[model samples]
Target: MGILKHYSGGLTREQFLFYEIRLVASLICENNSRDEIYNRIMQENLFQYPTERMIRSMTNICFKRIDSLASQMLMEHLANASTAVAKQINLYAIMRENGIVYDFMTDVIGEKMRTQQMDFSHKDINSFFDTLQEYYPAAADWSESTRAKLRQVLTRFLVECEYLDNVRSQALKPVFLFPELEEGIRQLSDETALCAFNCFC
Candidate 1:
């Protein structure tokens, strides 16, 4: 919910790596040091990402998203919650870690929901990016592929988190936050970000 000072294309690298995120959260819950976690992931191919380079890249992305949360309770929920709840928590973590996604959710997606506008399209995504470039001129430097992938990733994330029925439908779906997850978010004093989850708190 804080002001976005910059935009990042990190989401393009991975779109809601739910299993990988849960693994990282479980490792963190086990009190594994960062290096220990990274090494274990590298050695065991925990992410099953096909190659060393991919495994390393995914490990770094997972850590970047998970570490910024800095909430043991949230991590525990992500590691142990039921699938629906865990996915919601993972989406929350992503919004916290990625400003571009956070704004897209609250400003574009949330606004659409508020106006009862259910149609989501590539045009909407492009307009959002156009506005972002205006605010952060450096975002204009991203390659076209990067922008395309980001659009794909964000749409896929919305589907994964149940904010949309599916990519093809692109219809807004109501997201009712589990009480425990809502409480966990509140504990972080970031209840404002709950708008991204359709909580509108």
Candidate 2:
């Protein structure tokens, strides 16, 4: 049985939305297949948290009648995002640069699940996540050589067209991964603030 199905009977729609919120938030830091991780997050957050089957049963009713409410989740999360993620909406730029990004990642994962009726092995699942690890160097402890290898992966992702434009832009920024946030942010600037200031003002 699907993991979400196991606990879905108990979760509220609000609670299930939280599951998705956490998945996206975590995905920004941890590079796994968003679709696979989303499924797991649903199972972990809604099914097992407060109770089982009850909230989920209620959610089914609410979602059936209020379709828009189902996707209002990202709004709730943006309300709670740290100043960091809210700094700039540059994910679109990255997605333009990268290709075949998240769309492919999710679709492939879904197809895999549909065929096997099970989630992937942890090792296999975490492989894509390593792609996002460089941004969180404290948690990642990645080597320069490792980063060189990862850049190749990133380049491949850019060549593929699955990721949305926003994700493609965000994927390459890794604002915190390159020692400090400010330094990394500077790297992404199209022109130096000083240079721009001198030109315009």
Candidate 3:
């Protein structure tokens, strides 16, 4: 991944896409339940232990944002997932599509927010790129176009309106990018998932 990956927009699409990967991994792991999931995550080849809390925060925060943004029909559909296992899958899939994150998830930005203050060079971006790249199976072969789509969706959520005030602890968020080519990203970038999404936001 190139340093500060750039897209058609100024948002942190790459950062949020990284978080979404964590979301999917967590869900897949969750399908197996906490102990099993934790073990899979603990495997040195798989999930890293240090950022596990951030994954949980992402999940926790995502649901809240979804609840706030989704409509009664969408909410009802989520309710229909019924089982924890099923709900987990539905949520995982939705985040995959919508690129929306909970306001509190921005807290992860705090740890690396000052990365700019340092006289960082292009090399520094690799550390975060490595963290993001490792979370997914190395064998997975996603093309550049597909990856751009993933980042594009994430950029929508990282925009201004999606942020949380956090009156209790005031802090701005961190954003990052990697420059690449894309065609008609706008054709794909929109907040509305359904008529309800149009009605709600």
Winner by lDDT: 1
Model 3: per-residue Cα lDDT over 1-201, one tens digit each: 111211122223223333333343444434555455444544542434368675455544444433432243333333343333223323323433332221112213323343323222223323333444444343135455554554444333333222223322233333321011011111223222211111111
Which of 1 and 3 is the better model by lDDT? 1
- Give a tens-digit lDDT track for model 2, residues 1-201: 101111111111222132333334444345455455445545766435465454444334323312211223322232344533321112212221222222223333333433443333333324644644443333256555544444444334332322213322422221221112223324444222211111111
TM-score for predicted model 1 compared with the true structure: 0.90
lDDT of each: 0.81, 0.32, 0.33
TM-score for each of the candidates: 0.90, 0.20, 0.25
Counting clashing residue pairs in each candidate, in order, gives: 0, 27, 6
Query: Positional deviation of 151 in candidate 1, in angstroms?
Result: 1.0
Q: Model 1: per-residue lDDT, tens digit, 13-125?
A: 67788999999889988999989988999898777767888887887877877776768888898899899999888887788788888788888887877677877888888
Instruction: Give per-model CA RMSD.
Output: 1.9, 18.4, 18.1
Ranking by TM-score: 1, 3, 2
Compared with the true structure, the alpha-carbon lDDT of candidate 2 equals 0.32
Model 1 pairs in collision: none
Root-mean-square deviation of candidate 3: 18.1
